[model samples]
Target chain A: DVKVTQSSRYLVKRTGEKVFLECVQDMDHENMFWYRQDPGLGLRLIYFSYDVKMKEKGDIPEGYSVSREKKERFSLILESASTNQTSMYLCASRLAGVGELFFGEGSRLTVL
Target chain B: EDQVTQSPEALRLQEGESSSLNCSYTVSGLRGLFWYRQDPGKGPEFLFTLYSAGEEKEKERLKATLTKKESFLHITAPKPEDSATYLCAVQAGGDTGRRALTFGSGTRLQVQP
Candidate 1:
């Protein structure tokens, strides 16, 4: 079975503080993604990485950045957290050419 | 733009009741349609993947069918444990590099005794 693990399941940060969410996958998948899920807006993509040290901005990448220095790890960075940034963050990974993704348990971030 | 929408933001059913959830989509070219079940506070769990119209997949009491413009997830004799948020996503054509998926708001179902 494929497994994806997030560094934290819940986090709280003060406004303007830097925050980092880490994700790791054991399946050696080539594709990884970050998304923030909201009540009515659904899951909106924040960033994705296709290979080591490579990344792309998704639909809502503002105030967020990502790092993929290693194939098995992906990190989402909030340069300066704000209250509006609070949401359920999810990480997913899939093999090359495969359409199905395996996701981590998710990290719920609270920016106060 | 590519998009996916799910109907019946919430549904309540009695145990042993049968019903279907709808997922409507619009994309330039469709590669696959996916169904996922998500428990509260957890990520989605994959259920089925339909590649073309008339294609169907099943696991236990859940069945998923696909058409040109939409997909349906039918639950038969559902139990209380079946209650969860059902999500639908579409894989679009073009060099997305298998990057991202467009997801629906999801249909939350509750099954009672």
Candidate 2:
């Protein structure tokens, strides 16, 4: 079974502070994704990484960035956290071209 | 744009009752369609994947069938533990390396004893 792990399950940060969310996958998948889930809005992609050091912006990428320094780890960074950024963040990984994805437990971020 | 939509935003059923959930999609080209189950405050757990129109997959009490434009998940004699939000996603024709998945709003199921 594929296992995806997120560094934190819940986090609280003050406005204007930088925040980091870490994700790791044991399956060595080539694709990693970051998504924020909200009520009525569902899951919206924030950023994705296809390979080490390669990243692409998804539908909503403002105020957020990603890092893929290694194949098994992907990180989401918030340049300046704001109250609007408070939401449940999910990380997923999968083999390139494969339709199935393994997801992490998710990080619920609260930006006060 | 590739889009996925799920019907019946919420469902309630008595134990031993059976029902189906619907997922409709529109994409340039279909690569795959996936089903997942999510519990409260947790990530989604993968259930099944259907690739072609006539394909079908089954796991225990749940069965999934795909047509040209839609997919249906049938739960037979559901139990209380079977209650959860069912999500559907589609992988459309684009960059294969990207592995992007477009998901629906999901259908929340509730089963009572």
Candidate 3:
């Protein structure tokens, strides 16, 4: 079984503060992703990394950025936290080009 | 581009009552469709994956059926522990190496004991 671990299960940040959500996958998967889930919006991809040092923006990537310096770790960075950015963030990993995604427990952010 | 839409924003069922959820999708070409169960404040857990039309997969009390443009998740003899938000996602053949799954809003099922 594949395991994806997220650093923070919950976080509260003030407006304009920066936030970093970290994720690590045990399996040697080449694809990793960050997504934010909202009540009516579903899971919208924020950023995805195909491999180390490579990244692609998803549908709603305006306020976020990502880093994949190594094969097993991917990080999501919020340049400036805002109330609108408060939501459950999920990290997922999969083998390159195929297979089901293994997800982390998710990081819930609350920005005030 | 690929798109997915799940019907019935919410559902309430009594124990032993059976129900089904619908997922409608449109994509240039279909690769695979996935079903996931999500609990409140938690990430989605994989349930089943269907590759083509007429394909079916079962687990415990849940069954998932897939077609070219739609998929159905049928719950039989539900229990209270089965309550959760069921999410549907799809991978498009035309996506090439992107490997991104487009997800729907999900159906929240509440099974009462």
Candidate 1 chain B worst ten-residue window by lDDT: B91-100
Residue lDDT tens for model 1, B1-113:
78999998999999999999999999878888999999999999999989999999999989999999999999999999999999999988888543578899999999999
TM-score of each: 0.98, 0.97, 0.97
**What lDDT would each prediction earn against the true structure?**
0.93, 0.93, 0.93
- List ranges where model 2 is wrong by over 4 Å: B96-98
Second chain TM-score per prediction?
0.96, 0.96, 0.96
Model 1 residue runs over 4 Å out of place are: none
lDDT of 3 by residue, A6-112 (tens): 99999999999999999999999999999999999999999899889999889899989899999999999999998999999999999887667889999999999
Q: Which candidate is the best by DockQ?
A: 1
Provide DockQ values for all models, in the order shown. Answer: 0.76, 0.70, 0.72
- The per-residue C-alpha lDDT of model 3 at residue B57 equals 100
Write down the worst ten-residue block by lDDT for model 2 chain A: A93-102
Of candidate 3 chain A, the 10-residue stretch with the lowest lDDT total is: A94-103
lDDT of 1 by residue, A1-112 (tens): 9999999999999999999999999999999999999998888999999889988888899999999999999999999999999999999998965488889999999999
* Candidate 1 collision pairs: none
